[model samples]
Target: MVAPRDNWVVDGLGATHEFDRLHAVEHRHHHDGGGGELHARGRTIRDVADVLCAAPLDPRIVAAIRACHALGCDLRILSDANRFFIDAVLDHHGLRGYFSEVTTSLSRVDADGRLRIAPYHDFHAGTHGCCLGTCPRNMCKGQALDRIRASTAAATGGKKQRLIYLGDGRGDYCPSLRLEREDLMMPRKGFPVWNLI
Candidate 1:
């Protein structure tokens, strides 16, 4: 539930920061919105690609993701960055290979009720629309975690595995709230959710 932060929603043109609702993306040319306006600046697939390609990769997180893979934990990624943008970031960081599954709000449905796969970053372009009710924020972490539970049941013949989630933002609060009493959660450098527990 990593909400866009810092450069995540730079200059706030067509971005929203909520986890359960559309933040109502307003273009810079539009009249009103919060957090900022969605400027066409750095909003292109190519533009974002260059930035991600140049951004420094977080080695610690990378190692954590890799360790999850090595331990046979199903590693999945859910992000608000349209699938293409997320992929570009991952691809740039060389972390794409670490995730077992990736889901984003960029899925598009056509008139024929078929899915139209657009590049993750170009999803905001005209001639197409974002997937209906496809906001990653619409996906509650508990629900996503439930799917993981089901998969584990199928994989291990009904054996239950402990789940530990680490996050650092307001959106993460909901998912963290759903964690088992013994499960672990934390805010990067802010404060400990456990302290509140």
Candidate 2:
């Protein structure tokens, strides 16, 4: 018999709790927490995974990502989504191997023992301030991209490599701006962030 569908992410707090529970279980099974994701995206990991699996993924996009991986280019995912969910989605689409690393905010914690979403002033001024705010882990896309660049540089004998980022949301803005000429940034159609740069 088919099991009943579980909806763990009934609310924001429920989502967070779900992530924490999964992480705890995974930690016990692996017996090594260091190798897993550092940023936590929600309260529970499975809740995040459920949402991703329920969503429809584009096969063409998956193929493109796989092609990039075949070219010896690393496919790294930096998103606010919880690590478990994101990773599961990739695996479900047979694209897990494409990504060299995956970073999610659900894996990191702040000094206050909560998610660390950076508080940065907008380009305008104090009046138009915007904070990424506290996420599940310190796993903001900008920060993850920064970490990826540094790690790649270290691994590739300090060679500066190009970056390609794509997103359909406001969260993609800050990270895209950080890319250089060699890098590529793609945003969804009608997103104001795309026009700003």
Candidate 3:
């Protein structure tokens, strides 16, 4: 995760960083509920699209994504970020063609015009067996990685592909543990995962 900079301010999307523009939404309503319930009014998908389109993409990363796609690599994104934001970013950068799959939090606009965000997997429903409690209740990246591996193998006629994980947050640590010796992990050098490793 990027360290909090002096210029960083909390946006309506509840993000404190400048680069995370995907979470920026019009916060016209707010709510506090027990047991992971959120009652905040949400912006529409169209609103999110506007914010994401205006967000800048790193040219280097865009080039890299294109190169990976040209090589026929099976690119996937596993993120705790909301799907709307992730999708918008990919579309904005013209990098959507590079990724075969993207796993992220589910986002939707409710009838009351509230943006509802929910986890892809609810741990409260049942544990994912992550020995480390570092991950949030919404997801366990380790488990997601296992499922991805299984599906990838199944899709490729039981031939396992070499895995490469790139992440920066503490949530990434659990998934890193699941990687085999042949796999590669690229954690941001100064981020929590890299420091922990």
lDDT of each: 0.49, 0.52, 0.64
lDDT of 2 at 94: 72
| Model 1, residue pairs in steric clash | 12-37, 13-37, 13-38, 13-39, 14-38, 84-120
lDDT (Cα) of model 2? 0.52
In model 2, what lDDT does residue 38 have? 26
Return the top candidate by TM-score. 3
Give me the runs in candidate 2 sitting further than 4 Å from their true place. Answer: 1-51, 107-139
Best lDDT among the predictions, by candidate number? 3
Residues forming the 10-long window of minimal summed lDDT in candidate 3: 28-37
Per-residue lDDT for 47-152 in model 2, tens only? Answer: 4356556666566776777777778877677665445445566766777766777665333444534432222222123322225433222234566577789989
- As for lDDT, the candidate ahead, 2 or 3, is 3
lDDT of 3 at 87: 69
Error of 3 at 132 (Å): 0.9
Regions more than 4 Å wrong, model 1: 1-9, 12-43, 107-137, 191-197
Off by over 4 Å in 3: 1-56, 124-127
lDDT of 1 by residue, 107-194 (tens): 3333533323333233234312223322223344455555666886798898766767766544355566667776666556654433
78 Cα displacement, candidate 2 (Å): 0.4
